[model samples]
Structures are given as structure tokens and as C-alpha cells.
Target: MKRLPPLPALHTFLVTAQCCNFTRAAEQLHITQGAVSRQIAGLEDHLGYELFIRLARGLELTAEGREWLPKIQQVFDLIGDSVEQIGAKRETLQLKAPSCVMRWLLPRLMQWQRERPDAPVKLTASLQHGVDFQREQFDAAVIYGTAPHDLPAALHMFDEQLTPVCSPMLLKGAPGLNAPADLQQHLLLHPTHDDQDWALWLKAADLRLSNIGSGQHFETLDQAMSMASHGTGVAIGDWSLIGDDLNAGRLVTPFDLKVKTGLGYYVVAPDRPEPSAKLRELMVWLVEQAHTR
Candidate 1:
């Protein structure tokens, strides 16, 4: 059998490549920037080729590095999945959720941990809105959209209610946002490239703006909401997901109106004749939390 490169060096290379900066990678890895540099250098020497082209500002992956990245990620993912499926880790409930719901889901998970320290939950956040239980290892998932018909159990959490949210500073600014029409005077942050969320809200409000697609756009609702909280622009946010932000005054609703998109978030589990008592208990607790929120 052939010898493999040091696992620590490979892990360091992976983190450095993902961050594109030795300093940031060092911060994430809890090591000195010099140590990160050394690991990358060692990995490059072992591979007999340079993986990254270090620039003054940051690093850029060489062709070889780019090609090797996904393969390395898969290797690590498989290793992680294998470890979690065996022994004591297997008893922990694995949950997957879209990143859009972090504002709501994270706090609840923390509360759940406090209440039931014995029943641990391993959460994996992803960009994907839906999950395929057969292919994924999660015991349950928080899905956004219409209820999934194929799942054995799908517990409705809340409806998708869209409303404009921004920093409280926007409320005091000129051309005050007294009504939906006042949006024309301010920037509109779109959570998607297609600007569908903003469009949906506008259509529901029976209002239209010529520059609907004109402001900053983000890849996720969370990013748009973050910018909105900073007073960058007004974002069409899911009302349920931004409760914490609203409570903390980091964001505020500009209008009282909320438009229901006929979509919602649900806690779904795969088809199983009899789920574990712990899984059932977690799902019930999640639904109760959702209702209370």
C-alpha cells in the first residue's frame, strides 16, 4: 500500500484553500499564520507541485488546486459521515436545514440543548432548500416551500410571510417609509438573482417600481437581511425567520402589511415505520417551538 500525506497537512491545505488567505485560515484553525504557511508549503512539497499562487492580497488556486478541491471535500465529507454513522455518534439525531432559517433555528436549537442535554442534535446547514432523505444522512430536516408529499412526516412550522425589513435608522430617514409606495425612494435588496421575492411582495402590495431589480442582490435571504440591518436597503424578509432580529432592534418592519406566499417551512423526516423515541420527541418539541414563535 502507498503511503498517504499527513492528515493534518491535508486538513490545513483544505482550510487554507477554502479561505484563500493564510491569516483567515489561521484564525479558523486556531493556529498562527506562520504555521498555516508551513503546512501549505509542506503539502505542496509532498504533492510535488504548487497548489496556490500567493498574491499580495490573498491566494488564488492554481489549476491543479482547483481540480483537486472538490475531490478533497468529498473525501472529508465521506470520512465525517462514516464517523457519525458509527458508535455513540449514531445515537445523536442528525438534522439538516437551509441557511435561510438560521436566525430562527439556531436559537431554538440552543434552547433544546439546554433543556435536553442528554439528547444531542447535530445540525448541518446548507444552501439547498430541500433534502433527499435517501441520499442524505440526516434523521430530519427543516424544509422550506410547500409541504413535501413524499415524506412520512412533515410538520408545518409557519407560513412564508414576506414583509419589508430594515434598520430603525431607515424609519427616521427622509421620504419616510409610511406606505409600500415609499419603497421607490429607497434601495430594495433582493435575496435572489431573479428578484422574485421583492416582486412577489410588490405584486401583493398592488404596487410596482420601475427599478425593482435595481439594488444590491444576495445569494441568500440571510445575507440580504444582514445588509438591511446595517441600513443598506430594505429587504423582503420572511417574517417568522427574523423574529430575533426584530426583537433585538437590529431590524424593523417598515410596514404593517405581510404577504403570504402560500409556501411555508416544515420539519420533515424520511419514511420509517417507527422512528426512534428521541426523534419523535425532538420533532414534537420543534413544532411546539414554532407555534409559540
Candidate 2:
């Protein structure tokens, strides 16, 4: 390894320069601003170059700092990743998650971060219908379904059923939505899929409407949820996702009707002789955290 400066100061310098604010970096590092300032000053003395240009407003990286920032930051992140890998713990785990589960998992992931601070988590979403895990370069993926998935590396996680959700404002504004037939008057969000999820829900509810026409189409559940939150239309979202929204009062399910999706969340990975350690740890964590409903 190349000779390196003291880690604490190096970390302080990198974080501060990235934020362009000593105080903000200190807050993020959970250290005193004075300590952050001292570290940067020490790093400058060791390197014999000022890394920042201090202004009355805040700070800006010097030319030298700008050149060095990316390299040093990548090194710092790699160090963290290395520790986990060497320990047989985990380094970075790239995950392909359904947009719905992403919202639910992200908030709860803070607890996991606290436990394994060194683990790098790379989360991305999939909108491609019936994803090909290997082709996508994901270590593991969480998708909605229980069918005979073609990938042998996949493991079943959780089954989530569907529910109707709309902004509370919509429900409160229009009392006529108490019956399923009243959906004719409201906009409904639709996703492009081989399976029409909302249509199945309507059938389960035994309601007939003149219009099965799509009101607004979204490529991802997250976008659909956002639109519904803005009171644009009703969203037939899975509770595993929209549950938090429903609980937080952003949305409400005025009707009790819900349906079992033929699809649920599945955890998958690339088939190989041996998978990376980080991927394995993440797969276990994902299975343990699977939501039941």
C-alpha cells in the first residue's frame, strides 16, 4: 500500500472539502467543528498545501484539493470495503430491488448500518419487466413474484399482497369512493406489466366500471406513489410498500378490499461456483428482514 496520512485527519479533510462546510462535515462525522478544522489544518501541514479556501460564507476546495479529492475519497471508501472483505464480513453489496421495497428497506437499513458500518451498500431499482439477474450485473435482487423463477441462484423472500391507496386528501374530498364502482370518477395509476395488478384487484372487489382506461402511467412504483401522494390518483400499491405511507397519513385505504399478487419479493443472484462474501452476507440480511403480510 502507498504511504498514507493519519486516517482521522484524512477523513476529516475529505468530508469537509466535499461538503465545503467544516460544520456540516463535523456534524456528519459526529465530531466537533474545531476538531474537524484542526484535522484539515494538520493534513495541510503534512502535505504542505492548503486543501481549502476559507470564505466568510463557507469553504471551497483549492486547485490541489480538487485534483486530490476524488482519489483520496475512493481510497477511503476502499479502505472501509477492504476491512469488511478481509474480516469475511462484507465489502460492498450491489442490490437490485423493486422500487417499492427500496423505500421500506432504506429507512430500516440505518439499523444495519449501525451494526456493520464498514459495509458499502449499492442499491439500484429495476423497471424492466421480468428482470434477468445475471445480465444486470447484480449480486442479488429483490423482485415481486413467486413463480418458478428461471435463475437457480435465487431464494424466495416474502410474499406481499396488494391494497388500494390514495392520498388522504382524495378520500376526504370525495366521499363517493366508498364503493368500488365509484372508481369511474377518479384517476388510477397503472404500471406496464405482463400482469395487470389493478385489474385483478377490481375483479376481487367484484365491482364493474365502464372505464378500465389508464388514467396515468408510471414506469416505477415509487413514481406512482409520488403521484398518488400529490393527490393525482388512486394507487393500487402493495402494503409492504405503501403501508408506511398509509400509516404516516400520506394515504388511506378507504376500502378494506385487497388481493394476493401472484407475484411477491424474490431474492436472486448470479449463478457461480462461489459468490462474493459481501453478496452472501447481504442475501442473508435480506432474507432475515423480509416483511410478512
Instruction: Report the number of the highest-lDDT candidate.
Output: 1
TM-score, prediction 1: 0.72
Please write out the lDDT profile of model 1 over residues 31-88, one tens digit for every residue: 6787688668757876789999989999999999999889888989997886566426
Clash pairs, candidate 1, are: none
Question: Please, what are the lDDT tens digits per residue for candidate 2 over residues 124-185?
Answer: 76544346754677667776666545777776666667777888788778645777777888
Give the TM-score comparing model 2 with the true structure, all chains together: 0.61
Assess every candidate by TM-score: 0.72, 0.61
Native-to-model Cα distance after best TM-score fit, residue 171 in candidate 2, in Å: 2.5
Of the candidates shown, which would achieve the greatest TM-score relative to the real structure?
1
